[model samples]
Target: MVHYDERTPHLHYAFVLVVFDAKKDRYKVSAKQVLTRHDLQTFHDDLDQDLKKVLPFYEKGILNNKTLTFENVAEIKKNNDQFKALKDELANVEENSNDKKAILKITNQELNEVDLAKKQIDSFKQGCLKKHLAKP
Candidate 1:
């Protein structure tokens, strides 16, 4: 839902996080799996990518003030520090995600190689058995 309360039009979106459970072979409402830290972190980026494909004019950014509002300077400083720390954590998470993807690609390649070798071995065994039967 788009709200007019804010300075700019922003989506006040709400939906149940549903994921397909392979074990059950059916879709289930599992917020714990779908609404993950990684999912939340990448939500805006993914949304922006899709939105751009449809709405070319959709600008990517927050629709509100960027300032960290607080009564006291000390409290403002504290909030700023917290925000910085969270940003750092997000960067680290993204970095780790990239590393993991690279690792998975290599692992998949190795598994494919193993599968090919197994198929070749089986074919060779069948050929040898056929040759032996023909000789007899």
Candidate 2:
């Protein structure tokens, strides 16, 4: 049984009751209901009482290995956090790689311009040499 409504803007109470399906090897919701602001307290109290009655059966199922335990929830959370960190790290590395590629492209363009300038200077010097030699 889970109660959640924090993400929504409306002031409503929602409850979900999930049961383990041994045949399907998965958990399924057996019942779910929502209570508006008007009936929130009364419905919630009734739901709590119903859940209390089923609590012993749920516990018995866990003790008999018929139902899953929540011991792996913490591990799942840790793995999710690590996965997010790795995803962020990958994004950073990709961004840095893109920056490096842009820098390299600019550097290549500058080098080409420098080469062209050097060629022009050499051509000018050759023209001057020919002019002076012809006079001699």
Candidate 3:
């Protein structure tokens, strides 16, 4: 889903991990089997290549982040935790601040941070879309 309800819009993709079971003659839900090490390694690169096929203006390597690498699961989780804390703090700022102008400025900055954290988290999550097109 593409979210337009924010300062900077972002996309969210939800999926179920499934793999073919040749012996069983059917597909089975198996995240362990589907999310392989190789898939994690090249997921973003592959996605960028696939996106470029239909999106003329979309640039290759758009998923690459200069400050954060999605490969570090621990780092992503840490940042997510921090993001949550920051959001809670932003809420406090909105409630406590008396100056509307100051509140607006602070809210705008926090919103930008919210957008960045969302992008980072979502980029890490795109690995789940192995061979499926996420429904918008």
* lDDT at residue 120 of model 3 (Cα atoms): 88
lDDT, candidates in the order shown: 0.82, 0.68, 0.79
lDDT for each residue of candidate 3 in 54-136, tens digit (9 for 90 to 100): 79977634463553666678889999999999999999897777578778899999999999999988886775564356545
How do the residues 28-122 of candidate 1 rate in per-residue lDDT, one tens digit apiece?
99889867667766676677677878886877554235634455679978988999999999999999999999999999999999999999999
For each candidate, give its TM-score against the true structure: 0.51, 0.49, 0.43
lDDT of predicted model 3: 0.79
How big is the positional error of residue 31 in model 2, measured in Å on the Cα after superposition?
9.2
Query: Any residue pairs clashing in model 2, and if so which?
Result: none
Q: TM-score: which is higher, 1 or 3?
A: 1
Model 3 clash pairs are none
Best by lDDT: 1
TM-score ranking, best first: 1, 2, 3
Off by over 4 Å in 3: 1-17, 53-68, 71-73, 99-136
Q: Which segments of model 1 are wrong by more than 4 Å?
A: 1-68
Which digits, one per residue and each the tens of the lDDT, describe model 2 over residues 46-89?
65567668786432221223423333569778878999999999
